[model samples]
Target: MKTAAILNKNQLSKDDITHLLMLQDEHEIELLYKKADEVRKKYCGDEVHLRGIIEFSNYCEQDCLYCGLRKSNNKLKRYRMSVDEILSSAKAIHDTGIRTIVLQSGEDIYFGSEEIRDIIKSIKTKFNTAVTLSLGERSFEDYKMWKDAGADRYLLKHETANVKLYSMYHQAQSLRDRIGHLLYLKKLGYQIGSGNLIGLPFQTIEDIAEDLLLCRELDVDMASISPFIPSPYTPYKHHQSPALTDTLKTIASARIVLKDAHIPATAALSALDEKGRERGLRVGANVVMPNFTPAPYKAYYEIYPNKYLTTEDPVKRTLRITAMIESLGRRISASQGDSLKQKVLA
Candidate 1:
């Protein structure tokens, strides 16, 4: 009743929000998840969007401390897929009934604006799938070019809204610049997707609340609220990942607040706990992005270890995910899983 009352009221005190964040008991956690799922059903419906992610490259220029693909990590082998290989992967994803393909890579400059443009253009021209890019920060011209090339969305995770922690991990970058990129992507007509990393060192409950608040303020099409898993090669590798319960609390709170935004039951959550993703789905997540990156590369694109989102074989993986979705009594989304916010504005 307290949860319902707090959510129902137009405004909640910081203390009320802090209470929401501190919910750790199984019964209260279930209540929070149930409420989030109900709100999700109200806004996003029962269809779970599956975005086939192809990790096309691992070459990065930035040395972000927590990521394995940082520029200074010479021990990690790097590879960038040719345009043909990427297109071939997209075609395979389309063939398997996936409506969207996310071309995610490290912040590598090997692929120039025209090169990335050509890849985006080819994917849009050849397949019926929507293209989403996660190529870190790029020039405004590059963003405009890709949008003109028919890229449907751009995902640039804010990572965390706390400026201090963000600066500590990102070195010279500021939260303002990160947000500026998201705003620029939005201005270029791409459905902008931004999210936060839960359970980072020095992250507080207030920080978690602010993350959701920022997502609402941005009116992002998608918000990825996943638990933080420290990479082996990163500086804070020995640091602990977020507790599963803490992750679920953050996910549920985001759902209740964002309501209509598409939140994925992230692979990181599943990596931490075998049923974590399923629990997320039961609560608030309406999307699952299975790795469609063909093998040898999929295992190599390790942002964190022990990620088992999908197998090398796309066909078998699709069947397995479909069965998993069916088990949860949710239908697989058949369309391009376009932003529900877009429809709301329309």
Candidate 2:
């Protein structure tokens, strides 16, 4: 099938998505990326929103098969940032002129609902920034409390859309329940971000197509298309990482499909290719998350091995990322970079 024909369509079918993912010819793949770039410029413009991410805690309760932070991974050292320390990191992110602060950690219930609420309230009160919580799944009450406490966004990656695959990757977890959390967060008026891991063991191209379609179905405000990087001591430790080509293709396909959604060129992309961030921006990505997780604690939050810029100084890394974004002719977004879907809803 001609790639241009599929790219020209206003709406894409699962079959069209699958075919685009399977693009192999060098010129054909370039064409796919060009179309994605055009669509990205049309919807998101040239501003690359930088979201400073702080991986506050490494402790997790679930035993996921592919994550280094899984509870069963005794080889990993666990640590949690105190409330004061978390605020310190948020202040650092704020000082750097980043308008969005993402507080990400494993599903650690130790920081109970009240503590989480307090953290959200403190950040909002002190910083002129948007707080995005990526603390994994929690009760509906907790979600509402945090939202009421001024949390602006919630990120819960579905991991995979296939029910059985989701179960296999996350033991004792149900894909249905994960999607339920995403929907509830959306209904609660928090802009939601969700996406899939490309090239997992036993995953197929068709499954990736469905992943993008699921993002559209959920009407997510942000979609992250990241490659699966194997973590040491995990079940898939020896498994090979996804090809950079496939990862880029997924990003391009996602941009073509979820045009108005915020798509971030994740740090995992850089771990795959030296120029991954620049490559992503050239394709369709409009956001780049800079890690602000402070030292000692940052090193231990390894969901995967050798995360890009895991230990770099926050200021230095931000400077380098800014230069790269500028080199691509993209400007840094100064606003909170809220949900693009807001205008449509309003």
Candidate 3:
């Protein structure tokens, strides 16, 4: 059976993507990966853009059923870094020549609008780096405040676009509110980013396709695509995770559909497979985020189970990923000097 390529090469119907998802043979998976890699080379080339990730806080108010940092998870230890500690971490990351610092956290109420604004200001003031915030959901007022305070970008993953599935996973969170916040961020002149999980419980091909379409329609500046890994503490712990191949297919499809958006080979992808990040870059992913938080607080930054490999140091992990990209004939960029428009144009 011949399947269409969906976005660029050919017009793939929804059924083609379904057929691709149903293909389980190892050789078939390899073929898909190879095709995806070729597509990456055709579009993004081999250069990998590294963004420094600093998990500022783990205290979350929302009880998302799939996340390890949900408030109900009593087994996990929680911490929040002070402004000075965060700045110090950013300084170290900057010293490594990384040009963007992504400050991520759960929906922690402890840091209000003013506090977050100050944090963004301090990071920008102290270091010559771009600031990206991943502080979950916030009001429009808060979003405007943060953007005004020098936050160049904001990441808020929709997790899943299907409303019923979204409610099932989020328990008490509303899909409308989450999407509304994202639209609010976009309206506030921030480089907005949103994404979905690959294989959550009750996910279908139609659902994944809709997700890709939504990313296109919303015209997000960046999209993060990662496979769903079950957290042992979550209620959905027994659900099987999506195959890494399916994740790769979704990433490739995303690249084709959202051609101009900045897509990252997410660390979640790397966690599932050793060469996940490298393969992602070879298949239309141009961004790679390296954890740059202090070693003492690294373990406390968990959003999901077994995130970031335990065997290697954080800096070592970055170097290793960079080396893999270099092996693929791509360079790791030293500067985050390019604007979102500039990256899209490139």
lDDT of each: 0.86, 0.92, 0.79
Q: Candidate 1, after superposition: displacement of residue 82 in Å?
A: 1.5
TM-score of each: 0.95, 0.98, 0.91
Q: What's model 2's lDDT at 9?
A: 99
Q: Put down candidate 1 lDDT per residue, 209-271, tens digits, no spaces.
A: 888888988999999988889888789789999888888888888888887899999889888
Give the CA lDDT, 0 to 100, for residue 220 in model 2: 93
Relative to the unseen true structure, what is the Cα RMSD of model 3? 2.5
Q: lDDT by residue for model 3 over 169-230, one digit each (tens)?
A: 88888888887888888888888889999998889988998787778778888889999888
lDDT of 2 by residue, 1-346 (tens): 5688999999999999999999999999999999999988888888899999989899999998988899999999999999999999999999999999999999999999999999999999999999999999999999999999999999999989999999999988999999999999999999999999998999999999999999999999999999999998999989999899999999999999998899999989998888998899999999999998888877788888764545679989999999999988899999999887644321
Model number with the top TM-score: 2
Candidate 2: lDDT over CA atoms?
0.92
Backbone atom clashes (below 3 Å) for every candidate: 0, 0, 1
Candidate 1: where is the Cα deviation over 4 Å? 10-15, 307-312, 342-346
- lDDT for 216 in candidate 3 is 76
Model 2 off-target regions past 4 Å?
A: 307-310, 342-346
